[model samples]
Target: MDGPSGSGKSSASRGVARALGLRYLDTGAMYRAITWWMIEQGVDLGDAATIAARSHEPVLTSGTDPDGPTIHVDGVDVGEPIRGSEVTAAVSVVAAVPEVRARLVAMQREIIGSGDIVVEGRDIGTVVAPAATVKVYLTASAEARAQRRTAELTGTTVEAQQAAMATRDTLDSTRKTDPLSMAVGAVELDTTALNLEEVIAAVLGLIKERT
Candidate 1:
């Protein structure tokens, strides 16, 4: 699965994995884990040279289970901390580092090789797993994406959430390495008028057709 932040890739991929008895991998969370680690180490977020030099320092381990996907950095489970506002704000910048992408992409590929899994990320279909069996790119209107995000996090208006998501979209799509894009022959599903269940069902249908 490949799409921007708030495009329903994470939730739909997890649901599809659960329905198909496959493991789930959230690549964004892995990026966020690295961001959280960097923040803890007091690394300058705006310093690309420094961030790239130390990108390989953190040991990121992802548990590929549909029931309870977990992410750990340096022996500590950081499922919650990685989702903090601070981490979210810095992840795009840290993730743009070529070294960071190389390190994490290797880790992600290693995990995917272990077994059947639905890996979700901005570039999974295009870069991480180009030969994936089923590639579904989910998209939605900006307003719908913002509303969904606002519902997930409190104290944020839909408009405000949408604006931040737009910024992340620009960064993720324009980044030099593995930019967010639909792989060739990827099935594009517009979920602007559909609910989560509808999106999951559509993905499952695509898998069935492909299989």
Candidate 2:
């Protein structure tokens, strides 16, 4: 699974994982885990070399539950901290580091080696799981994505939310290391016209047909 944030990639991927009895991996949360670690260590976000140096400093682990999985960094649960506004503001810079992607990609590869996995993130299908049995690229219109993010950000104006999403989209798409892109042969589902259940059913049907 792969798409811009707030595109229902997480929700739909989780549902698909459950319906298919596969492990779920939120690769974005893994990057968030590293971002949280960088903040905790007071590493300057602007300095990619410094962040890259400690890319291996902490052990990051994530619960595989399709719903409400937990993420930890070096034995400490940093889930809440990783999702904070501060980390959200700087995660793209950290995630753009080549070394960071290399480290995380290795870990992701290891995690998926032994079983079926539904991995959600910007680069999973394009970078981490190029050979996945079923690669899905979930998407939605900017208006829809902004509305969803506004709900999460709690009472934010739609304009502000839209602007932020635009910036994030630019960063994600233009980043040097494993930037977001649809993989070859991947199925693209525009969720702009589909409800959550409908989206889930469509993805599940795709998997069933393949199987």
Residue-level lDDT tens digits of model 1 in 1-211? 9888778988898999999999899999999999999999999999999999999899888998888999999999999989989999899999999999999999999989955899999988899999988888889999999988888998889989989999999999999998999998899999999888999999998888999
Candidate 1, residue 11: lDDT: 85
> Over the stretch 102-209, how does candidate 2's per-residue lDDT look in tens digits?
999999899888658788999988899898888889999999988887887765787887888888899999997798999998999999889889999999998888
Off by over 4 Å in 1: none
Candidate 1: what lDDT? 0.92
Model 2: lDDT of residue 75: 94
Residue range with the least summed lDDT across 10 consecutive positions in model 2: 149-158
